[model samples]
Target: MRLLLCFLLLLATTLPARAEVAGEMAAALREQGLTGAVWALVTPEGVATGAAGLADAGTGAAMRPDHRVQMGSVTKTVLATGVLRLVTLGHLSLDQPLADILPTVAIDNPWAATHPLRLRHLLDHTSGLDDARLWQVFSRRPVADTPLMQGIARDGQALRLRWPPGQRFSYSNTGYTLLGMVVEAVTGERYEAWLDRAFLTPLGMRDSTFGFVTQTGPGADPRLAMGHFDDGSTQAAIPWFTRPAGQFTTSAADMARLAQFLMGDGMIDGVPFIASDLLRTMGRQTGTAAARAGLPIGYALGLQIRDRHGVVGLCHSGNIVGYRAMLCLYPDQGKAFFISVNADSETASYPALDAILIRALSLPPVTPLPTAADPERAKWQGIYTPLPNRFDQFAYLDGLTATVMVMAVPDGLLLTNMQRPDRMLLPLGNGLFRQQDRTIASHVFMEDADGVSFSDGGQSYQRVPAWRFWLGWLSVGAGLLGLGWLLLIGLWRLVLGPRSLGGMVSISALLALMLPAPFLIWGQSFLALGDATVGSVLLAVVTGLLPIALLATLFLDRRRTGLLPWLDRLASLATLQWLTVLAVAGLLPFRLWG
Candidate 1:
């Protein structure tokens, strides 16, 4: 006990306090089974930058604030500024429909409404477009089959209208891709090149660039801070086809400069980078408070606007497979905070970091939870769901199933994926709660005598009865068993009735078809297709059904019961083939709808 106290005291005293924020941040990563690199900057007058842990744990290189790391969705904040600059220049307008900008380029499946998706919708992420990707768009090589717009059109056309245009907010990466196209159309330049000329060059951001991972160059060091999985194993940098949406690389110094630019009212080094009117416009409320209440304030163009202790600020966060970043600017106080992690644990460091910055800057921090707000209390307990958006379900996938989680936190509640529990949401008075670094507005719960309903922004979900889980599984098992019984009965009929070889082939095909029948009947859009392969289907028929039919022939012959041995071998192969098909199909539901 003495040794334990001494150790604790030593740790408390020795850990970097302001710098220990990094250690606290690092500890947060470790607690969630994640490890990688972190670059954090808390600026009172100038930036105090620090790094903790490894850039590449496998290589033993210590993380440095100077080391370049992927900024993920932080790129969106910058790109949104660029797109808005175009809008402010009379090259585009927020009210103008997207169809007017690039008349020739089809948007694919446009929302059927009088008010088509506009530049405001794209910048603030109110566009109803389903998130889709064109892998070829971000490729260094020429795209052969799938073009970005074509894929958008194909998938977008099929998507059900989740919400009418601008009726409810939904974050769609596809919207940014559309905005990227607008940049190209208005500037007569490629999107990345325009970013270089408009945002990076003007701001003198020397180290930042977009699509470095996909673009061929010696520029992006593959040896830079590597992203890691929750288990601390390395994660490969994702190849982003939508560069503007979530792809950029920078050092802490560069990000700090960007933060300064945002905090400085769109000016850097005396040269006006963007009009101040444009900056304010970008931070303007695009969605209503009632529509997006749980949010800290509301989403601005590529930024979330909210007030901490009555100080209104603009902020944004980024996440890719292995990276996460948060950037904040307090315009009223002329202060900013930037934090990035190479191995993202999906923890909410923004709130903690915000508190630290406010304290460090001598500005009042956001109101802290009262001592009375015990997390252990039942009033703060219950399952809460976040607002509906594109990334909500996909953000949290369990082993092979998707799950909605309710966070039971002190003074606040969070509903998140099993994977990302750190996105804790605090009630913003009334039923509203904030999520996504407090940029998104949403509500927590609506209760009644029957059960609880989880709503975000405006959408609602009733509690799924517990029995539905078992009943679902039971139904699937019964379906598979029933198919098996049909197969056995068919085998008996073939043997007793002297069916022809053609009839036998037809029966085999039928069984092959039936093997996947259960999934097609009861699968989600993503799972119904499964990992189905034509070869697997063929194997199922040849090995399982054909042999069964042949065994029936032998049983009818009675003298040919000897052939049952060969029939048994075929039946075993058939079973193996069907099991493989079913296994692949089973895995699909977990991936898509889990």
Candidate 2:
């Protein structure tokens, strides 16, 4: 009894000193303007966890080691871990065709008979499905009456493969969502439950949970910190039905444990949890994922493989509405780092902390991004389309940029981003480039027989054929002219009064609604307006009546004057041309009734 009392006093005294051990890391977070962050570092030597700033910005709660955070896409690692366990049991195979497993869900694979998408495609984000772009509107509350399977099936039917399977890397959350459904179909168990039993419980990640992350719920643990926005505004907690993709909530300590399991011998409490070899397999690059010099960026199964001066590491980064997270493991060093924060706007800064942890742990610092230019700029010219995405947003807008010109200038090239007409890209050698002085290494230039494959870091774009390229420009010019005509007619009506022009006010007003103003008025919020809204129905009605108004004016003129003025004639033609442009460019993203 006396020995126990003396040991307790000694241990309690040591804990506070250990908590203050990573003061340097806490200082880095403060320098980056992060509001709150929980970071845990595990090494073969020992484990240390540090958190700086408030756990809840609203309540001024001091951060704690056990505060839970939404894991965002890092949940993919957990999903992958569970699937690999099934693979070890002989219940599933990594190379097994996904179609063979989830037949109830319709997957639009044009080349399925030739190159069927295997289960590995889901893990690697190489499946030809869209990334569920429109479905982001369903983030908090999805469409009523739609289950995960139905949503996946509906999206699968609408989105065709942008490229052949295993062609190149294109991240898709829809693919991971489908993978979650596959897990349910085979085991007849819920994904979160299976994770808890197979992975979470075995790995001893007690704080991890799924569905909605909040301070209160039937199974709520209020130890989870409230999330905040970049502006220091409190963010309301929300649910994600897209389970496998983003429905994850965990703590730094629990994440560190998961990381420890990955780097360890795969035995916990003297029983093999998962094959250590399989976990290692999940850490390296897979399929046709490219590698650039100085920057080790490529996707492995559910992890991102990063190489810094040959110090290899497996990592993944994640984000929810108000929270962000990152986890990386260095097997060579027998070390792992996990950190998550409570603010959404500050999440991008979280990745930088990975480098800080690496250096602090005595590993090689991350390679500095390249800056030199490649003089051979002409080779970079081509008509590029956005990398195959589930959402047609970029494809439509970029397609209309009229086969964007990548012409060689004295120092660099002029490029169009669908939004900007011409932005100069200064070539930063090693097949990379940048748009502006303040930009990070933004462009990665890779070429093949199809054309030059270029990535602006966010989305991938490929060169298009000549004819389609010209059509894009023509369509864009027509759209601009059509918008100009509408504004001009409205101004003319304001001066001349609505009494003189018949059907002019209605047509002009309808066209103006098409410019996102109506969407803003009708959507639940500004962010929601990009897709659909309460006012979308009225907007769609106006759009549908547009051609009728133009045709009515055309026929009425045919019976009236002997000759029409050139401006009127051009206005009439431009209106008709604009509709054709919308159709050709595939910008019609919404249904009139829907």
TM-scores of the candidates in the order shown: 0.63, 0.81
Taken over the whole model, the C-alpha lDDT of each candidate is: 0.57, 0.68
Candidate 1 runs further than 4 Å off: 1-19, 22-33, 42-44, 108-113, 133-161, 214-223, 235-238, 269-271, 281-289, 292-296, 305-313, 344-363, 368-594
* Residue-by-residue lDDT tens digits, candidate 1, 128-187: 555543222232232222233542333334433344566445667777877777887888
Best-matching candidate per lDDT: 2
**Candidate closest to the true structure, highest TM-score:** 2
- Candidate 1 accuracy as lDDT: 0.57
| Positional deviation of residue 540's Cα in model 1 after best superposition, in angstroms | 14
Give a tens-digit lDDT track for model 2, residues 1-594: 999999899779757555554565567657776668887888886677778778777888988887878878898998888888888778889889987898766666788878788898788877766776554535334532236675454434544676777656678888888888888888888776777877788778888865555665565567888777777877656655465787788888888888888877778788776777787777554455344422234566788765433345788888877778888898877888888887777334565666666665677554444457677878878777666744654566546543455777887877865555577777777677766532345456777666677755335577777678776567667756865665676566566744224336435655556664555555455334333455555566566566566666666554444333345546666767767666565544244222
